[model samples]
Target: MVSAFAITRFASGLISGTLVDKFGERAVFSSGVFMVALFTFLAGLSQSYEQLLFFRAAGGLGSSMFSVAAGSVILRSVDDANRGRAQSVYQGSFLLGGIAGPAIGGLLSVISLRAPFFVYSGLLLCSGMVAFFFLKGDKIGKEDKNADISEHTTVREALAMKPYRIALVLSFIGAWVFFGLRASILPIFVTEELNSTTAVVGYGLALSAVVQGVILLKAGRYSDEKGRRAASIIGAQVVLLGVLLLTFSVNFWMFLLSMAVLGFGGAFISITPASIVGDVIKGKGGKVIAIFQMAGDAGMMVGPIIIGAVSDLFSYRAAFGMSAAIFVIALVLVYQIPETRNVEGPQVKNLRPLDEDL
Candidate 1:
């Protein structure tokens, strides 16, 4: 648990983004998938936990590499008008993975923990091969080699953009609450607080995931027409309500309701942030995006460690309540950030020439 994904998942965005920016998406993705495929297979062969961590870390880097590079590639490949739908599909994959992994892991765990590793490897290897052949549109090779994207745009710049900064901070806080509950506190709530059976908790989680998946689909389209800020306001409230349910839940019905609400709110946070970052990294697609993805990974990494630690020493109720506080922070930050819906400014026209339209 300590080494399986925590360290590796943390570094995915930065490493992947840099590779994409430097080498290009097709190459980076191919290399990343190959890494995951190789290590996942090797992880299955390993007999010790330490060895598993090493293998998993390698795979995590590869997986993250694909995300950073590929995400940027998708954004840059399309026009602003199509980004919302594109982001929906991309971000939806995460929730899909979260949903599928446990099911696959469960089925495979019956055979052995190593079983899933081999399965993951083969899948990545197949994807890597496909990307190598099908990515005919990559412009990385054609762009200015000494592009000002890297030198001029810094983390400070990202922070300086009020909207970007708000997005980043809110992303961090949102991740803190979302992941902290799943990793540190949810099981405790089920077993100790609710006296729920293991199967019940599993089913509850599955249902919530399904709800989140639906929300992502619907909200993506909704946010495309409405401002992202509007989606965020409603999303924050949904999560706030979900957290409250978890804290005050008295029965299985309440627990189920909390999960659904949590899923609903969480979906908006996931969908909006990706598109927002895409907007910020308009020109230097890969490099700027890498920084953004890295910041997100850093937040996800730090959240459980800090929040979980606090929860471990204190009560479960307090841990959940604390997570809600983080959501509130996200809400406030989102409020301050300027909405990018229907970008209407002179700066935008000048920044991106309509050289091509998707």
Candidate 2:
């Protein structure tokens, strides 16, 4: 059952991104969360381990489905003028969720494990309502004769683009560095080195989210005007520095401070990649967003396993040390990659009657 959870999660992300293009974000995002709430509630009533396992996998599917749809909504709804900031707020909402989910879950558990299920349902229902009203998509424009909408690229075509190819690899590294350490192995470092408790861990993580959210809000605006590459390069270097600092710091207060620095690095996660890929795609918003997300999931899967194994052989410090190396590689990659804004926007011209392609 434990293994099934991981298996389902990885698979779900891949499919979710693709599906978003066809359905549009509103229906896709709303229904995905609704499904999870329903299935999870059913899981609570499960009498056997088999039933619970099925529900767990179902929930994973629901979660990724939501990711795919919501990303598309944000990408398409906001114009180029405000995309970075809009997405920053969209992502910051997740920081809010990250805060509420565990706090409410732990609180509800005091009353009953089942109590959290009801809370999850309510939160999702409210979120779905907002999206249903505010989220808009020009799905029909993709089919319009006069719009000059470009045809969607196949996965192969997306991969063949040199800049996009680099974006994919960097995205993987970003997701790996940001998320991989949180679950199976890195928490050990937090507890042992910091000697903190449940409340402390919760607060520490929340602090990161809060700090990162603010930084992202400001950074997103800069990315839009100055260029996304600058934001990413700065963020990557901070993360690398944070990782290095984590290795050397022994004091509890120092540990807390370093986590904030790590949070500073986390600010670039969504804004950087989205801006980069968005620049490359120009008009094909949904497809490029999907491609960017796929790279993130790839990183999430690969980074943890490798880091965890390294930790087993060496130490958490060593694990983070390796992550530092990866971060350096990310910095190098990001630095070398061309700034999307620096490139000219595609030229639009009506084809002449004499032109053979016409």
Candidate 3:
């Protein structure tokens, strides 16, 4: 069931991006949210596993649509000077919701197994309605009227740039470690290797989320002020340290420390790569943004399987060491890419011409 949703979401991402580019973020995002709400409501009423699976998979289409459109909206609306802060706020909100969502679902589930679904569906419907009614469509591409032809970047053109190519890799690595390998393997490692309970896993994850959430805004501000390369190099190095800590950890305390480190470093990575993509496009490249989104989704899908296989064939330490190696590669790539901050105003016109090698 999970694979079904992931596959569909991955496959539909480009379609969502195209729609956002054509219709604008407000319309596409609202329509996507409404579609998700309808499908989720149907899922709650499913009488069989097949029906539930079908509804869930169908919902992935909407999920991809809104997710891509949301990224498009952020890229289009925010300027280079404030883009990092904007992305940081966006990520921090997502972290807060992620931390709270399970708890809310648990409470709803107490009423009935399907209660959470119903509640989630209703909330989504409300959100979609609010967005459709209140969001200003004119703000998304307000600068497009005066945008030079060079301001519009195609996916191929974006990929040709060095920073953007590296940004895609960084996005993949970020998702691979944080969303995929850690989520899938950490619990098992805690329970089986460290001899800890599931409760310990939850505590560690909660701690990580809390730490990440608390630091996200500061990280964003730092990226805005210090430049993307500075923030990304620092972040990648810290993440490397955390993964190494995880690799060598022999007890619960060390594991907890590793999680905290991962969280702290993750906040930097979470915002900077998106900011880089936004910088490259200068706030108008739906197809370019879509390809970037697809890279992370691919990481989320592939990372667990590859890392888990290493764990099964070798050891948990080996699996973590593998993750550390990937982080090392990301750090090197980050170092090679040029700083992508403060590239707005008069300098914007020279961006493409400067990257003539691409």
Candidate 4:
């Protein structure tokens, strides 16, 4: 049942970028968040598994649209110097919600299992209203409100850019290891390998989120002020070290420490790639952002099943070690990619040449 949501979300991610380009960001973002609110309300009212599945998938669809459009809007709104900060704030808000929502939902569940969904629906609706009214009516850097989509760069052209491709690859590996494998399998690893209680595992996960949130603002600033390249390289190395530590950790404290380190690394990874893409793509970022997001979604979809198979075949340690190897690959990719933060406005034009037919 959960798989249905993941699958649909993945599919939505693939096409949502195009939709963002065709429709403006404000319209798409507002509509998407509203859809999420509506579907979540429906989900809470669902009487059967089938109805639940349908609503959940719909919610995923809305979520994909919201993510792409929101990112595009952020990139469009900010100058290059503040792009990192903008993305950091956007991602930080998400992390804040992740940390808070579960706690609130747990409390709501005590009242009724369906209560969280309904409350979340209301919250999403409120957010949608805020987006509709607060987001400036003008397109990102443009004077004309009704410019044709054909004036912007196409999806094909965005993917062809070297820096964009590198960012996309890193997003995939990061998602595969962080969201897919570590998030799903780490608790099991803690219980099985470290002989820890589920409560301890919960604490460790929460600790990571707290640490990630604390560092997100600084990390984003570093990417902007220092350089996107520096942030990516340091983040990849830290994540690799953390994953390696987890692989060899024999006790709870060691595992907890590793999660803390990973929290910082995750903050770096979350902020820099989008910052890099935003630097290179000046106009509508729908296609490029969508492709980057799609890669991450693909990783999220595929990583756990494959890593779980590896764990079954050998051991959990081997599975974690495999993840460390992925971080290593990400490090190499980040290293090879050029620094995009300092690219000038003229460079942006040259980077993504306009496709008249687009």
Candidate 5:
């Protein structure tokens, strides 16, 4: 089941941005949200494992579309100075949903196995409608369609820029540790290493989500007003500290403290990459956004397998240490990228034509 979702996400991530470029952010984003809602509802109705997997895969594809198109719209709509803050708000909404969904699902599960899925489907559809109506001026209007398409930068052109490359690397590393290991390995670490209960794990995650929500507001403003490099470096170092603390944690309290630190790091890490891309792109950057999303998705898919292997071969401490090492590497890369906040570059000009090759 996990593999089906992961594989589909990775695959969809590659093309979703192109779809955004060809159609429009409003269309693609709304459609993706609607697809997710529809497929999730279908999944709930499935009686067989095969049918469930199919629906889950479809949901993954929908997620890919939603992420890429939403990111493109957010980046393009905001000015250079406010891009960081804009991304923060977008990311915060997702985190808020993550926090709410599990609690709602848990409650609904008591009524029936499929009740939560049906309810969530309705919620997603409502979100889609909101996106369709509220995300104004993102679609290339009929009068400007040809000119907009001509002005948009292709994936190849985006790759030639240094900031995009740096952002991609940071995103891949961030997703690997924050989404992959945190979701899959942390619970095991709490249970086996700290001799804690699932309730403790749940509380720790809930606490982290709350902290992340609060800190993201400050982090986004800091990145916009200060500099992306500085904010990202701080974020990576903080995450490394959290990983180090988690590596040595022996008690439930220590584990909870580490979760708080990790949450703080997540505040900076989650939105920085997308904002950086916004810094580098001139206009609708569908292909570049798609590639960036794909890198993060790939990391999420791969991180668990690597962490699990490390835990099996050595120990859970070793797995945690490996994650810390990855953060340190990301920190070094963050330092190498030039500061993008409030700085104008060639990429800030009108979008260029597509490279003939791609």
Candidate 6:
């Protein structure tokens, strides 16, 4: 079931980004939200496993659409000067929702097993309505002076830039470590290796989220002020340190401390990569943004399976060492890319035509 949803979401990412470019974010965003709401509501009413699976898979398309459009909206609406801060707030909201969602679902489950789904669907519907009503005008940002709304940086053009290429790597690493491996492997490691309970896993995760949430705004501000390169390098180093800590951990306190460190690193990861993408494109680049989103999604999908395999074949320490190695590579790449805090406006230079390179 999980695989079904992830596969469909991954498959639809490019298409959703293209659609967002053509139709604009207001329509694409609302439609995507509505589709998720509709499918989720149907899933809630499903009488069989097959029905639930089908609904969840179909919802993945909407999820892709929503995610790509949301990124596009952020890229389009926010200027370079404040983009990092904007992304921080955006990511922080998701963190808040992540913390709240399971609890809310648990509460709703007391009413009925399906109650949470229905309520979630209703909330999505409300959000869609809000997007439809509030996301008015063609260009939301005052700095967006591109007379041609149709003008967009192509994927090839975006990839040609050193900063953007590095940004994609950062995005993938961020998702792989923070979203994928941490969620999937850490709990098992806690129970089996640390001789801890599931409750400890929950506490560890919550502590990580709290630590991450606390630093998000500050991280964003730092990215905005210090430069994306600095943020990315620091984030990668800290994440590597955290992973190494986890690799050597023998007690619950060390595990919890590593989680906190990882969380602190994650805030910078969440902010800088997106900010770098925004810095590169500086305007509508739905396909470009889509590719960026896909990198992270791909990481989220692949990280667990591969890392879990490593754990099964060798040991948890080896698996974590592998992750740490990857971060080391990412950190080196971060050093190669230029700072992008001042890379603003619609007229980016040296971008070849889309057809010229491919």
- 1-358 in candidate 2: lDDT tens per residue? 6445555656766576655655556777777878777877777777798998998778878777777677665654555556677768877888887877787799899998778877777777777777667665454122334434444555566667766777787788877877776655656777776676655566667777888977978877776666777877888888888778877767656666777888888787557776566555533345556657767877777888898899889988889888888888888887877766533432222121244335
**Residue-wise C-alpha lDDT for candidate 1, range 203-275, written one tens digit per residue:** 7788878888887877877767676787777778888899988888878889989998888887777777776
Better of 3 and 4 by TM-score: 3
Report the Cα lDDT for residue 261, model 6. Answer: 95
lDDT of 4 by residue, 189-263 (tens): 999889999998988888888999999999988888888999998899898888898899999999999999999
As a TM-score, model 4 comes out at: 0.92
Choose the strongest candidate by lDDT: 3
Which pairs of residues clash in candidate 4, taking residues 3 or more apart in a chain or in different chains? 150-358
State the lDDT of candidate 5 residue by residue for 1-358, as single tens digits.
Answer: 8878878878987688778877788788889999999999999999999999999888998889988887877787776678888888998988988988888899999999999889989998998999888877624411245464546667788899888999999988998898777777889989988899999999899888989999998999898888888888889889889889989999999988999999999899888888888887766677788899888988888888899889989999999999888888898998898877665522345433467325
What's the CA error at residue 151 for candidate 1, in Å? Answer: 12
Per residue, candidate 3 scores C-alpha lDDT tens digits across 126-212 of: 989987887775445233444465657888899889999999999999989997666678899999999999998998899889999
Candidate 2 wrong stretches, greater than 4 Å: 1-6, 137-149, 194-199, 282-288, 342-358
User: Which of the two candidates, 1 or 2, achieves a greater TM-score against the reference?
Assistant: 1
Clash pairs, candidate 3, are none
TM-score of 2: 0.86
Off by over 4 Å in 1: 1-4, 9-15, 138-143, 146-156, 343-358
Please count the clashing residue pairs in each candidate, in the order shown: 1, 0, 0, 1, 0, 0
> Please, what is the TM-score per model?
0.89, 0.86, 0.93, 0.92, 0.93, 0.92
Worst ten in a row by lDDT for model 1: 345-354
lDDT preference between candidates 3 and 5, better one: 3
How displaced is residue 140 in candidate 3, in Å?
A: 2.6
Candidate 5 residue pairs in backbone clash: none
Cα RMSDs, all models: 3.2, 4.1, 4.3, 3.6, 4.0, 4.9
Q: Which is superior by TM-score, 2 or 4?
A: 4
